[model samples]
Target chain A: MESGQHMLRTGRRGTLFEFSMALRDLVTSYHRRGLAWSLAWHDVVSRYRGSILGPFWITISMGLMVLGIGLLYAKLFGISVAEFMPYVAMGIVFFGLMAGTINEGCDTFVQASSMLSQTSLPMFTFIWRTVLRNLINLAHHAVIIVAVIIFFGLWRVMDVLPALGGLLLTIVNLAWIAMLAAIASARFRDIPQFVMSVMQFAIFMTPVFWKPDAFPDRHAFLTLNPFYHMLTTIRAPLLGQEADGLSYIILAIMAVLGWALTFSVFAITRRRIVHFL
Target chain B: MTDVSIKVTDLTLRFPVYGVDAKSLKKNLARVTVGGRLGASTTGATEVTALSHLNLNLRAGDRLGLIGHNGSGKTTLLRALSGAYEPDEGQIEVRGRIAALLDLSLGIDPSATGVDNIRLRGRIAGMSSKEIEDKMDEIAEFSGLGPFLAMPMKTYSAGMQARLAFAVATAVEADVLLMDEWISVGDADFQKLAHRRLLNLVERAGILVLSSHDAGLLRLYCNKVMRLEGGVASEVKDIRRLDELLAAA
Candidate 1:
């Protein structure tokens, strides 16, 4: 409930005031994170409501994908299944989370258009909803990661901490990207299609299937791909190897720079987003 | 909780009507090379002035009615007052918890049960879990959905859906309640219940801003009335003079 003063003024705001207001909105939405979690859970449950397997079906399909692609690519590359199964399984899972979050982020505002137009609900609520819902899907797909890692007998219990940290960092990075995509796509309807195509092309280019070790000479190009760094933050840690310092450095820089850019755009356009929708 | 107020100074809101051309990147990219004469008509988003330089103030115990012809900014003014739209020129300052019944069906999810939707709406209204739980039965009772509350909302008729939404919306006991129109939902019996419930909600409210076409309804609830003509508002006149104002219009 709004217990204090609420003010809305026209035209440009002082940078400090605008950013402070935007930061306040983020904080307010954070307090309402429970609502977002519930909505995201509802989104997942309701989508698969009457089905027997329900959301588990997503895991099943993802399981099939990792197995199919992991085995096929392992044979094609002449690598042992043990060497490749865990890598591809995790790549698909983590990449799915990243792309799905960014893709669905295109709908952040558009999906909440009804509530946004009629109520004073914080705009960030829907962005978190989109991110959380995709995160839930990632959870379903995580079963594949667990089964693959255990089948290959690949991880130490201590390795779980770093992998969890990597997962958290990856989610933080995707959150800003999703917010930006949602903001842009709310006004430009074609942005979603464009995003979908870009992500599709990105899957092949980001080494989700092929390992970077397979082409050691081209390692410099991998560093240039932000998705590769994001993937490494999670995949490398889970495989019991240290992510290159550059990958974590690049990820930290991306998180900081991406959030800064997203916040600026969001602060300036927060109010006008309704009109765009 | 008692000192509720709303003040708008020279508030103006313009809606940018985005055409398909303006929304499409493909067409815009195509027009970069062929973009000279088309600039004025093709990709430019047409702006419609929804509310222009409107000013209003209401304090505790004030119930103001908004009357206007269709597309004369009635809904737009309510939306701006609700903080759903930003003022394009002026400022809107409000003190109180606001419950805007601008769109009854705005948050209803058909796939969810009626009971679940009440929770969803409650969450949207910024209610905590305990508060929503406490109000759930009361809202369900007021909606008169009874056993149907457990069933998915999709099975309910449009009127039934409206009933659930209205019940949950009005349950908030808002300090400032902004309503688009008098809700007429369900059978004659439910309408009576809804009207009584709304009257009670408005009675407890510190300030009420209702926009409606029904003069009778306005006279019953509002102490003052204002007419909007093409995004411009007339003076806030006393409710007793509504007939004279209507006749003059």
Candidate 2:
């Protein structure tokens, strides 16, 4: 607690040096084990208290959505049932994880305004809870992703390793998004709405329903869209193809930049947080 | 002064409220349309001081009552003492944790069961889950909301809700207990239990600062009284002076 106070006081000076040190301390303190898991479990059980097969409903709905969309999009795109089915199914799973993470990410602190405003604890707990809930949702939906891939004969020796990589990258991406959005949304209050509008445009701009190769001339724009790269990183690798190092580097840079910005903002504005709340 | 366990020196806190600065609608419109300054040579926006150069000291076993009109900085001082708000211009040093009953209703979650909310509030009070579990039966009995303990907190009546919050909050053994007003837990049998519980809790706390306008109650319970007016503490030079002032009035 003394160290926590020191970090806060030094943070108030707003020096870049103090800011980075505080950020390091913040990340290190987040590793205090089991706190996040307990809170997240609390969030899950309390959210669906009365319902039977509560979280299983997540899996059932997702499976039905993929099945319905896979058949419809396969016919609409005039592609073979065999090839198109895998693509659409994988796309829905991958896109769901990406969009759900960012959408929920922006509201992480705002939604937890109730908890944070009352008790003075580590801010990471709120962010971690958001990340954990999404991860839980992913786990439920992953059953669908797995069932579809196995049914379509997409599972292979190399597929296992790439699937792990995809999961890891997705987690890392969501973590970064949560940290960034919490700080931004806490400050602006309008950033969540702005993010929602931007996501609407990003849905069409990214190659979710369509293939990346659909835009032959606008290759640069496709590459610039981080989601395009994230999807490619996860989906391509799972399909037993080479993952893009360029996209990985791009995402790595974005993650670092995002954290840096969040750290500075959080350090500068932490005391003001209660006032806003 | 020798027994002083908490000290506040020249404390000042300024809040910058964000919005148009004008005090009136007509003035705001004039400033917006004509680009005219509302005040003589400066913009209408300025700092509204919530606390200004206030100084006080308190000792262990002191029960102090604060009395003030609305906007008189009673809540701000409480917030500052509890470390909720940082003072801009001076120092406040208290030896132990300050438990403030500023807003009882805000800490509770409507969606959670009474039992669950009790656990959550326990955690907020720095009690580990294991500690809360150990006291679970005691807290349940204290709340007096039998069978409905398993129901959502929103289902409880206002009095029942206050019982749950008060039960959980008092479960913590605090160093200093700050109360804004007297919280009455309103059933006859439970009210007696609550009174005994509150008296015991207040006795255990080393320092108690209560803010209320009821002078007779303050004289009965508090050892000292401090008057605040226009964001400043009234200058009572000594205990004799304070008593003289209170007696003369």
Candidate 3:
């Protein structure tokens, strides 16, 4: 129905207006929570449709990695398996979530090019769908972390509350990261490949397979790595160790900076994105 | 009375071909360091102007037809109206809820069942879950794929998929309806039913913008028509006169 109101307008818009519009699109997508949740579930279910193990395959693979790496590394480092397995499990689980999210985030817009052209939904919807799908995948792999903690008798009720808080913060951080990566990768086709290679290299560089204590002389280098801070925030709490105040400070700074950067990029490129696709 | 209108003023759209220049980081960095002119020439970064300063207007009860040859920006103009492509210059103001059927099966998921695809495609068509749920029975009945609705969409034959997609796409009521081409569905019987349904939808819509190469179909459905060539549009005042011109050509 027409009420002398313009429902859609395409032309020059001020920077602030464009930014607010992009933000409004995000809010609208959130309000349509049903669509996002349904799509996310659809992604996970269809991906593992015919497999007997379904999502459990991720849990099994991760479980084996933790067990195998934990035994060899604990012995190699002169630590008990019980003490090290939980650390390895939590580290790998959280790292998998981080790296997997970034890896998939790059394809969020490119893969949805068809749907985007076919429909006029908010750009944020695709980003949220990617994040939700990765979150679901993380939930599947989390089964291994819980099992390892229980088996090693490393469960601490007091640590659970903070660990959940840290996990929430990490998820929030990754949401911004995903948005930034999705937009950049949409414009430059090779960004996804670059991100994938960087992530593969990051796994060895980050403390996923080893502990920070093992590299005392290179402690400063570890402190400078944002991935290290992201992992530590969730890993320390899960291991029943207190995360240093510096990690929280770094995370808060990163979140603020990341959102600012992502918002600017999204606002500038929101309209031009359709052309790129 | 519900009113629908679309006003486009000097709309233009250009697509950038990100060739060797911007497709890769290495090439882009080298270009930035070495300067733009040399890099641009070597990499062949060029822009394709799909739509020029084209202007048009439509109001309620208007069934406007677009006739154009291939790559003549007919699809580009329709896409611009649907808000799928943003214009590089000028302005477009659209009033009313729009349902664009650019491609019949654009959003259908093969892994999803026929029933599930109805919901997915409905949402993609800008319908709320409740709206889709309310219309589900009618769409299902119209599709005539009762038992097959439970099967995956990939299992459906091409005609079956087309029928399902057409049923869902036209089920929703909108003030503005945009279509790239006339969609024909299923066997002879279903085609008749689909034809009737399409007529009803076009009649109900406050505005309709359809693009096709068929001149006869345009004369039947549209009172006014415009022909596009090389990103420019010119009105064809008399359908008979245009037909004569086409016959001569």
> How do the predictions measure up, each by TM-score?
0.95, 0.81, 0.92
Q: What's the ranking of the predictions by TM-score, best on top?
A: 1, 3, 2
lDDT of 1 by residue, B131-205 (tens): 889998899889888999999988998888888888887888678888887465468888888778767766675
Candidate 3's residue-wise lDDT over B1-249, tens digit each?
A: 255788998887786776654667776677778777563365444788887888888888777888778998898888888776767788777887777888876867798899989998887776788999999999999998999999999999878887898888878777777888855446987878876876786667577788888776777667667778778877544555566535442
**lDDT by residue for model 2 (A1-277), tens:** 3221111111133367456545654664465334566667677887788889878786787677767777787789876666666666667677777777788887777776655543445567677777788777777777876776787777762356655665676677777776787766665566678778887788778876766656774379877887877777777766666667777777777777877777777766665655544
Q: Write candidate 1's Cα lDDT for A30-92 as tens digits.
A: 877888887888888888977998878878888899889889989999999987999999998
**Fnat score for model 2:** 0.05
In order, the candidates keep a fraction of the true contacts of 0.70, 0.05, 0.56
lDDT of 3 at B159: 80
TM-score of 2: 0.81
Which CAPRI level is candidate 2?
incorrect
TM-score of chain B of each: 0.92, 0.79, 0.89
DockQ (Cα-based) for each candidate: 0.66, 0.18, 0.53
**Candidate 3, overall lDDT?**
0.79
Task: Name the best candidate (by DockQ).
Answer: 1
Interface C-alpha root-mean-square deviation of candidate 1:
1.9
The C-alpha stretches of model 3 lying farther than 4 A from their native spots are A1-6, A215-218, B37-44, B236-249
DockQ of candidate 1 (2 decimals): 0.66
Ten-residue stretch with the least lDDT total in model 2 chain A: A2-11
